[model samples]
Target: MTETQRKVGFLICLITIVLAVLDLQIVSAATVPIVRDLDPDHGVDKIPWLVSAFALASAAMLPLYGKLCDTLGAKRVFTGAIATFLLGSALCGAAQSMEQLIAARAVQGLGGGGLMSVTMVVIAHLKGPDEEGTGKGGSAGGLVAGAGMAVGPWIGGLLADHASWRWIFYVNLPIGLAVLAASAFVLKLPDHPVRRPLDYLGAALGAAFSSALLLVTDWGGNRYAWSSPVVVGLIVTAAAALALFLWRQTRAAEPILPLSLFRVRELRLGFVIQAIVGAAMMCAIYYVLVYLQIARGVASSSAGLYLLPMAIGMSTAGLLSGRLTARGWSARTFTLSGTATTALAFGLLALTTGPATSLWLIRAALLLMGLGLGQLMGQLILLVQFAAPRHQLGVATTGIRFFQTLGGALGASVFGSVLARLYAADGPGGDVSALARLTGTAHAEGVRAFVSATDVVFWSGAALMTLATVLAVRLPRPGRPEDTEQPARQPEPVPA
Candidate 1:
């Protein structure tokens, strides 16, 4: 690829990130209409699954996607992934039942998961040349990549507001076509085909553990009450599956998630930090939506709009942190500082009374939290990649994301439940009639409950973030977010 084409290829991938990451938050704004259309009888309480299920799928499938990326070429896998995403989006638009919607979402999640992780690996491969303008350690490349992803929620909101919420998913169609076209002509990726075989056993075990664990978590409190037979059975089954997964991964020749990567202190610590960070962030967005639309009577579009500050705050923080890391600051500094800042931010947020409570205060709180989270992903990603042998970067990168995926799923589910619990008694005299008339009828009680419960959940998220800060301090700085050491041998084989 010529210089111009490389730039264009890079731009195409940026568009891919926008389409992919938007899957996570797109439902945040669209769930209202989705629930009305899919399960009018269930109301808002049960509708979170519409949003949370996709998150769970994307989270659960991240490693699956990563492992496949290693086995498959990035271009092949990327094209396939986007195709699946577009198919899922169309299916979601036509979904007629809750079951159908959930299944369609899983399909989207499968592709979304691939899009999330491969973009990084692909950028690494595409930007291998250290041309004069490519910048240090591909930092410019990484920055473009990360920044493209960070803006997903904001773009998602914009689409949901101006177009129908369904357009959020639909928009990916044209973009995916454009990416495919660009890749065919512009993107020049070095093929690194390794001799390692795909570890199907490992994939199956990982799937068992991830899917079952999340299923139990999602169904435990809501589907069957805590002690229901179904819940108990799921929990017991998940424990057994996870145990088997651990045992098999130890012996697999090419494990989907080689546990050996954790031997590196920085890598292991980074993985833990990623999980904690995911949990904290997952909860923050979940509760903030609650506070804005439910507790305070803000419009749906306005609620999505409020989160714009958070995206901006994180963008600024992400860029600054990358620059700071380049200047020789340690990961420990940014990670720990971010966590501390997040704690302060969330603590302040927990004190806010309502959406109208104070715009500046909310902005400040989100700003701090975003700043902390901004540098998080790219920084630790470098650590994990650095710790791995080149040939193993595929599995290793996926492994880090697996931990993050699991944490995010658990975080979102637990937080949603917490929000529900916090507002169980929210209605006036336990009567939702007026609220039913006031809010969307089918969603009246649930919406009110989530709103009333937002404060408590936000406080809980705040506490979780505080814990993340402590974990962040334990890892040594990996140096720069972009300056990762190459594996002794490259992970992708050189093209002939």
Candidate 2:
């Protein structure tokens, strides 16, 4: 591919990723409007499913998409995924009931799963074997995706308030169509479909495990007690399904996820670090929003506006780090430094949690946190890509994303449970929005109680990031001459 062609293709891929990630957060601000319009009577309980369904479906299909990319070629799979997403978007926008909306979201997520995984694989191919780090292209892609996440809620709120909540889904049509048109014309990768058996059984088991596990996290403390029979049953089912999946991988002709990838030290470490970072990042993003809306009594749109500082910090740092790494700076150094910086930022946030705390102070801490997160985001994938065998690139890339998604789900569940418990103990019986209406002394006490809960959350985040720092310290430095030149070896076939 020519330089110009590569640039165009990369941009198209980046746009797709941004859209996929944006859809995840955009609905948050629109939830209230959606409920009011759709199933107001029972919508509050069902609204969570709209988000949960998408997440669960996306996470479950990740491995399948990875394998599909390898078997059917990235172009075909990617284009199909985009079309499927567009279809889902149309359905979501036109849905008449909560159940219809949730089902549409699941369809949307199926396509979204491919959008992230296949694009990374395509980018890896574009970078070729000689590129040592996540090049400028990959870093730029990450930056755009992060920005989408940051702005999604603001956009959603704007639409919900001034226009219609349906616009949130409808908005994707034009952008997605353009992406498809551009990719069809600009992407020039050769497509040679492999005639091999896919691991159907393994894929089924993997999906089952992922879905069950996500359910356990999403429903554990929110809808049911942690020790409730349904939660415990889901946990057991997830464990059993995962065990069966792993055992089946050893016997399959073409396992959807190659277990051997875990044997690579760099890949293993990269997964671990990605999981920790994902958990910490999710917790920070979520609770910060909670603090803004519930404690500070800000509108959803304004809360999103406050997130801009962190988003800018992330984009700037990601671009700079990618450039430096490409120029031969050690990725390990950036990872370690970023991890430590994020931990420090979290500590600062814990200290500055009171309602009377300066908004500027909170913004500064969030900026630091985003900076730290950006440094690690693209670099970790670069490490994993560089270490993985060429044949397994799709699986390896998706594996990182898979673990990260799982971590995010787990973090949200655990942290939400903690906040609920603390809030109940401090001052019982009020919905999140109702707490914002407290007056005088009551308001002061409510804010204090919210701050106390946030303090614990941030402290926990700091500890997680500190652990990530230790793992980053163990990561091998980039720019090894031999490592860059090593040819892509044919990966071993799955056991028959």
How do the residues 373-420 of candidate 1 rate in per-residue lDDT, one tens digit apiece? 676656666656655666566666667677887787688778767655
Query: Model 2, 1-496: lDDT tens per residue?
Result: 8889888888888889988988998999999999999988999999889898889889989888878877777788889989988998999999999999999999999898888878887787777446746455667766676677777788889989999999999999999999999998888875644467889899899999999989998999778888999999999999999999999989997799988877776788789888888888788888998898787777767888888888888898899998887887766777788899889999999998787889899899989988987887777777787788867777888899888988888888888888878877895345344576778887778778878988999999999999989887776555443433343345545536
Name the candidate that leads on TM-score: 2
Leading candidate by lDDT: 2
Q: What is the lDDT of candidate 1?
A: 0.66
* C-alpha TM-scores of all predictions: 0.82, 0.94
Worst 10 residues of 1 by lDDT: 131-140
Worst 10 residues of 2 by lDDT: 479-488
lDDT of each: 0.66, 0.83
Error of 1 at 386 (Å): 2.4
